[model samples]
Target chain A: MNPLLSARKVSFGYGAGDVLRDVSIDLHPGEVTILLGPNGSGKSTLIRILSGVLPSRAGEVLLCGRPPRGYPRREMARLLSVVGQDPPVDFPMTVESFVALGRFPHQGFFGETTPEDRERVRQALAETDLYGLRDRTLSTISAGERQRATVARAIAQGARVMLLDEPTAFLDIRHRVAFYEIVTRMKEACGIAALVASHDLSLCAEYGERIILLAEGTVASQGTPVEVLTPGNVQAAYGLAVSCDRNPATGAIRVTPLRGMPAKNR
Target chain B: MTPRARSEDGRLRPGPVFVLLGFALAASMALSASTGPVAIPPREFLDALLHGGAGTPARVLLSLRLPRAFLGLLVGGALATSGVAFQALLRNPLADPYILGVSGGAAVGALTVALFLSAGASPLLPLCAFFGAALSALAVFLLARRKSGVSPERLILMGVVVGAFLNAVIMLMVTLSPPGRIPGALYWLMGDLGLGTPRRVAVLLPYVAAGVVLLFLLSRGLDLLLLGEQAAFQTGLSVERVKTATYLTASLLAGSVVAVSGLIGFVGLIVPHGARALVGSGHRRLLPAAFLLGGAFLVLSDVIARTASPSGELPVGAVTALAGAPFFLYLLRRNGGKS
Candidate 1:
């Protein structure tokens, strides 16, 4: 079976410095693959490259079996959907209206949303449990609910691949766990090859089948959470000495980085 | 659950009917006039419009008030549509035709013509102003365009800088001019609609009509653009192309209006907000509503200006700013002091 997205030696940056350099990764079908990295470690940059928002400075990227740019923009959008971090929109759209915008790639410029498009939006709202608050203004929603509304929008895109950037960064502990559950359910039921960029090691441990660790604009490790979420690896990238233990209550691994004296500065 | 949710096609059938109503409003406003310095009866106004404005009253209407009224409609519609486009392209609520250096450039050009040279009723100043407005808009675009595309914030920042600098240049030109032309230059800066002629209208109408049509068609793209650049692009939009087309169309519309009307302020800045209040931000509704409501509002303003002072006609710009300023403050207060 072919991977849904492939990157090889891809590099990119702003004028300041390199954000992602010579990075290669693959996202496969029917799996929840989390791109785990510390903050400012090119996770969002890699997502932009694969999603074709930012041009690669060097090397190549492919969506499905061919060069990503070879796909028409609409075709690419039909193939992939993305939910970005910090969902700060300044429009007056209601939650339902904003979600309806995800169907842009699937509809003609003037074409009204068909029955199918409406149904997709309805399903996404139902899945995200936002059906009750669909009429509420997006500005009125809590940050966590807004985050899930964004996820619901991606689902409405009806794409095969889903790239999410910091999906739970602003969520409280409860919503974080709830979001992970939703992620796993989406992976099984929709079979979308998901690449979620996150800094939370616990969320990766609980929900991610595979974790790709990005550090200093390159991939530091790629494997199961047990292999990549080691204290040594985390300390190497984050410059922090950390201890890992299993939480008896939830049966999930937890990472605790030491504070004062910077814990020997890694 | 509202029983299967609202369907898209099942919405808003009364759209075209409203457009027709708007046309009737504009026509009635145009035909309904009073006996003043240039007295023309209402019946004669219609007769002149249908037949030829060859009779005394008809000729007076054709030559003066007719052009003035039509210029108000064209300028109002053009400015409002341009405002809508600018707000969408920049994704900023405060942007308007004047926000982008077009007005400053046109002011400079008109001042130069009024101060440095002597002219008859030849429409030379407005032509110069048109070129100046177009050039300033082009400068804004060029300064903002970088590697991938023009950033909205960069475009707006550049427009503000360019506009301020252009105003400085106009000030220098005026200061350096002969003292005799100072009053003329000052009058030119204040912006009056009397500079309009039927021929200027002929030139200005096509650009405004074409721009409004093109922009109305691209209304959906504009709506998508409010999502910011990356989101807009990821949703299958050709952001660069859309941005260029919209900027070109908007600048032309705004430029032509300023060329003829001489820096009419506040109409474009406020009309879109009013329309959005009535019709919502969906551009399909907002565009036409803005056009009609803007035209109606400006015509009424012009009438008030005509009737305001007994000694002489006040500048349309002064009148507009006065009428629109207090209303803008009220809006700000009413909307919880936003913008």
Candidate 2:
């Protein structure tokens, strides 16, 4: 099958610098794509461009078979759910109400939530393991729970594609794994496509079928975990020396770096 | 959340509140009709309302108190709802009814009408207020537009400048106005409710109703917009379109209130803040609650304004300012760390 969404010769930038240049990538159905980069290397920027939050300055984005602009706002929303990395939303809304927001694009602006909408919200909360905390206020929750809550909101949107920015920033290793498994279940159960930006290479090694690395506003390298997360390529992009190895039991790539190794050894 | 708990919102709790508010507002309006200048007893007030009482009491119930209280209700609801929408649109806790310079523009417009018009119930002051408010809104919108979009900062910034200019224009118009006419103009600045007759309320009703319904309809979009512009845009809301709709709707609502009652400050600011504390910020609940509480608040304030001191009456706006400024300080202290 053709890729579900793709960026064609997409180049994006802010004032004085290019964030991503001539980057062409396809996000296929049933495949998880990870965008990896150093802090300022523009993975988030590319994610925004593909999600249609930030327009591409130089190229085109296609969702399904049409241009990004072709889909109506509500229809586009039905196709993709984006969870941004924002400090907790300032409102102290209850967790369920916050999650209910995901149902906005799906339930038309005027209609009440149908039974299907209710089921989707239930399914999302169960997937994120947030069912018990549904009645609690957002401020009372832990950071990991809040992050998961936001992810659950996206799932409640019932979108086929999910764009996540640093989804695990607030999670501990155990919760992070728990979170990814839920995402894996979401993919398997719902066929939702996921494009996540992450600093953790192991996440891609564990969950991603493909990876794209960005450096200095350009796609430096992209391939499967074995090819893209290699020490040479990642080190070049991150400007640091790192070790990459596949876990024999899990088969996920684990990356650890000597913090300040010499350039020659890098 | 065992399914029972998960269904809290879809259950009776949230829905019942609306029903209760509607009953309470209707009762309050009837109560207001009984008190006014003539102090008509309830029986006569109802008789006057239904069959027309004997002379001044009849005129008082029909011509004065009923119209005044109804205007107060409509204006109060409009301002409160506008305040909620504008605050969410700005994503700032401190925003209120006058944030977009509607009050300042109305002041100038009212002053202009005071200075020039003969003022024999000629629709001049309301017309002037509407234009001034509309002009200020357009100016603020234009000034706030940015390359990315119209950011809240730009809107607030433009409002401050244009609001200052409008204030200056108001003072100039007041100075040029005849000294005898100044009291009436000053009454408006202090927010008088004595003047909004049935005619005034009738004139403003359509705008108020349309603006409020627009906000209620856009409540979902407004909820999404609260998640910051980029988040809102990515979620399929046209950020620009929603922002424009919200700003214009808010401006129209505030302007309509200003046109009739001058700048009644506190009900707009305090009512929403109070409702937010109780209902949380989900516009679905908060917006309607704010409107109801705001309506109740102003009617009560008008009662206080009319009855207190007994040396005639204090301006309703002054009463609100006295109350609101303190609440504003509290909000400032609460949000100080955030700013």
Candidate 3:
């Protein structure tokens, strides 16, 4: 089967320099693709391109076999959703209303929330464990809860593919684990495709079906965690000396960085 | 829960709030029409309004107070709605109708017409003011645009810079003008609604109505924008189109009011925030509530402007600023000076 989302030789730049160079990747249905990169490695840029937030300078991005931009924005939103790095906190709106915003693409021009939309919003809130706090203002929620609220919004969007940029950055460990479990469940049960850009190698190693290690705007390696998280690839991408091992019981890849040599006196 | 939460959960629907405000506005308009220095009695006021009684009371009611009150209502509603649109479009709580320098541009336009065209009738000033406001609004929009798009921060900055420049131009025109024209120009700058004739209000009515309707249609989009631009975009909002449409509609609203009432400063700045504090942040409820509350607030202020002094009426703008500046500071401090 064809990938649900694909980027073909995509390139992007911000006036002065290229941020992503000839990068290509595919997100398959019922699979989790973890994009691993150090700071300034063009992970965010690639996600933005795929989500159609930023048009690629060169090359094409296809969502379900057609150009992402070919679809009307509302139609595009029905098929694809993105959870950004930071959730907006300035507005004083209830979590329920915030989550209901996900139903935008589905609603008519005036965009009134119907009973079905509310039901979806309620289900999304429950899935993210945020039902009890639905009435609370977003400003009053904790960072973890806020992240979940955004996740709930994406869930409520009912998109087939989700693109999350550092979604777990603000989440605590418990919530982070829950979030990954939810993602895993969605992939298995609903055949949802996800492309998550994250820094948490260990978490990605355990949950990610395929890992794409990016460095300097290029895909340095692509394969299973065991293949991509090799010490040599990690060093090449992140410029750090690391040891890679597999957990005996879980059979998950483990990465450990070695200490650097002491500086020599001048 | 908190008192705010209790209130939100309580029996304060947007429908009743609008009705209540509507009643309050009608009552205030009646009171304002009667309570000026001439002081037409309640019985006389009613008789004059209903039966068209012949006398000085009827003449004052028909000629001056009624027109002024109507102007106050339209201008107030226009400013407040404009404020709501600006605040939502820019996603800045501090954004007011005048934040984009449209008022300053209108002031410059009005001052120029007052100084240069001494032969122009009272009706010509608002037309000139509207032109000036539209020109400045377009300039700000152009200057704020970039390859990435118009960010709220850049828009606000451009507005401030353009406003300052317009103010300087207004001052230059004031200094260069004939000495006799200075007071009229100053009163206009200070926001006088005394010039609002029934004809002028009629002329400006359609633009304000159109702007309000356009903004009402876009209220849902504005609500989504509170989630930030990228989130708004990801949710299928054409952020650029929404931004452009909102800015222009808001400018038209503000400019229409400025053209008629000079620059009634505070109604636009405070009414929406006050309305939000009462109703929640949802624009569908907040915009209409702000409109009614704003109309009432300005009519009451105009009442004070006319009644405060025995010798000459205080400028309506002065009354608003007296209340608005303090409220503005309190809002800033309440937001911990961030807005």
Candidate 4:
């Protein structure tokens, strides 16, 4: 199947140094792609580049065969949505109202909310387990709940592709699992192409259909979990000793760091 | 629980609130029209308004008081709507119409006409003031903007810097002027509705109406703006375009008002907050609510300015500042705890 989103040798930098260099990836519909990187490995920057929030310094990124910048903002948003790490904290708005804003692209500039828009917002709130907290102000909610609200907003956008930057960073384990489940369900139901930037190695291993491990502005490894989550690749990328084993319950690759550093780092 | 929860969605039914505010504005205008040194009774004021009687009370009510009240309404409503737009554009609740250098630029333009041209009460003054305001607003926006984008903090900082410099220039002009060349310039600087002729009111109506309507149309964009720039852009808003339109429209409203009625402070700053408190922060509702509330507030303040003392009239700005400063402090204290 053709990829819904593709990046070819995308490079970006701020000031002098490059944050990402020669990075390429593809995300096909009905698949979850986990982007793995340490701090400053340009995961967030790459996501921004792909979303057209920031232009790449070099190389190409295409969403549905056109450069992201080529599409009008609303048209681009109708196809792809992004969930950032932080929810808007400055304004006083309820969760329901906030989530409904994701329907902006679908609605006319002066359009009132249609029943379909309402239904989508309701379903997004329900899926994210935010129905109970929909009336609560975003500022009044807990960080994890706010993060879920952010995800709910993106889900309400009804986009074919979703790029989430550490969306579950503040979520608890249960919510984290639920988040993955929601993405998986969406993948199956709507065939969305999701690229989630995360540090949840084992969790993403179980959920992500493809994994791309990035190290120092370059792709260290890319493939299925077994091919990319090996001991040598993890140590080489992260500079830490880690043992990769299989989860007994699900038969997925599990990565656990050893007590000390790797011999090369030492 | 479900019913109560649904009601808590922050969407206050806007219809009743609008009716209440409209009534309040009408009542305030009547109160302003009735209260003066002459003190026309409400019955006679109503009679004069309907029949257009050619008596002293009718003459005062029609020619002087009603025009002044209508001018106050336009000025206050324009200032408040401008404030709401500025607040949304900057993504900061503290932003006011004059928070950019618009007010200072208007003052400088008025001063230049007053000092150099010796043009007293000429219509050319307002036009010059508007040009000055637009120029300064554009300067602030351009200075704050970088290749990446304009950050709200940087925009506000540039506004402050430009405003202070313009203020200094104003002071220099006032100080160096031959004392007799600019009469009532100080009072004008302090803000007054005394110049609210029927012609002035007619002139300002289209500006306020256009600005308010434009802002209403951009209400959805403003709602998304509170989400911050990147988030708004990601949500399908053309963020920069919206910001540009909002800034220009807001500047036009403020500059025109300042030209007609000199530097009225605090109405722009405080009225939006009151409106937000009444209706939620949805711009479509917030803009009208703020406009009505501001009209009522300023008309009442004008009444107080007219009648508060046994002496001559005080500038309307003095009355607003007297009320607004303490309320602004209270808001600051309350919001300080939240951040």
Per-model TM-score versus the true fold = 0.84, 0.92, 0.91, 0.94
**TM match of model 2 to true structure:** 0.92
List the lowest-lDDT window of 10 residues for candidate 1 chain A.
Answer: A85-94
Candidate 4's residue-wise lDDT over B154-205, tens digit each?
A: 7768988998998899889888999778766677777899888788788777
What is the Cα-based lDDT of residue B12 in candidate 4? Answer: 60
lDDT of 2 by residue, B156-206 (tens): 668778877877777777777667775677787778888868788887788
Categorize the docking of model 2: medium
List, for all models, the DockQ compared with the true complex: 0.37, 0.53, 0.55, 0.66
Q: Which DockQ-derived CAPRI band holds candidate 3? A: medium
Candidate 4 segments whose C-alpha is farther than 4 A from its true place: A260-266, B1-11, B113-127, B138-158, B175-183, B330-339
Give per-residue CA lDDT, model 1, range B1-339, as digits (tens).
Answer: 455433232223436546764985566456424424777766887788799767888877777777777877888888888888888887766567776787888767666666666542335655666667778878887898898877556776788899889878987987887776645455446556675568867767777788899998888788777777788777777788888888777777776676566667778778888776555566777788888877777777777777789997777778878866776556545544432
Off by over 4 Å in 1: A15-17, A85-91, A241-262, B1-55, B107-131, B138-161, B168-188, B323-339
lDDT of 3: 0.83
Best by DockQ: 4
Local distance difference test, each candidate: 0.76, 0.78, 0.83, 0.87
Give the clashing residue pairs of candidate 4, or none.
Answer: none
Q: What is the lDDT of residue B169 in candidate 3?
A: 92
Cα lDDT for residue B222, candidate 2:
83
Predicted structure with the largest TM-score when compared to the true one: 4
Q: Give per-residue CA lDDT, model 1, range A91-190, as digits (tens).
A: 4556776778788899998537799998999888897888888876666688888988888888888888889999888788887887788778877887
Clashing pairs in 3: none
